[model samples]
Target: MALRRRALGLALGLVWGFAVMFSTLWLLFQGSSGEIISQLKYFYLGYTFGYEGAVIGFLWGFVDGFIFGVAVAWLYNYLSMKIYR
Candidate 1:
């Protein structure tokens, strides 16, 4: 069966986006934002270690996850079709 790329992408994006937002906020409130900032900085340049940075990270994560999920679903659907055919 073919996967719905857009639906998969949106679902993944929202989940990942919110997860990043909530997790970052949690760390910030818990006074552990520094560690996450350092880690994210290593992966994402110009990432501030504050609320603004968390918001930016959330957006980036959402876009990244959405694209990834779409690609994965597309590839799976294509391969499955070929195999079944």
Candidate 2:
């Protein structure tokens, strides 16, 4: 079966964006900055363990996930077409 790149990208983008935003909020509520959350600042510029940071993380995550999902779907479709032919 062929995968739709746009659909996969959109799905992944939303999921990843929400995941990052919520995780950040959760940590903020807990009053502790986890190691992983802190490390995210390295990858996502302007990201911190704060309210604004959550939005930044979400945006970064969405873009990152979308690109990754699209690439994977494209590769899968291309390889499937080649192998099935």
Best by lDDT: 2
lDDT of 1: 0.80
Prediction RMSDs, each to the true structure: 1.6, 1.0
**9-69: candidate 1 lDDT, tens digit per residue:** 9889888877777777877888884764557767655566778877877887789789988
Q: TM-score for every candidate vs. truth?
A: 0.86, 0.93
Q: Model 2, residue 24: what's the lDDT? A: 93
Candidate 2 segments whose C-alpha is farther than 4 A from its true place: none
In model 1, which runs have C-alpha deviations exceeding 4 angstroms?
none
C-alpha local distance difference test of each model:
0.80, 0.92
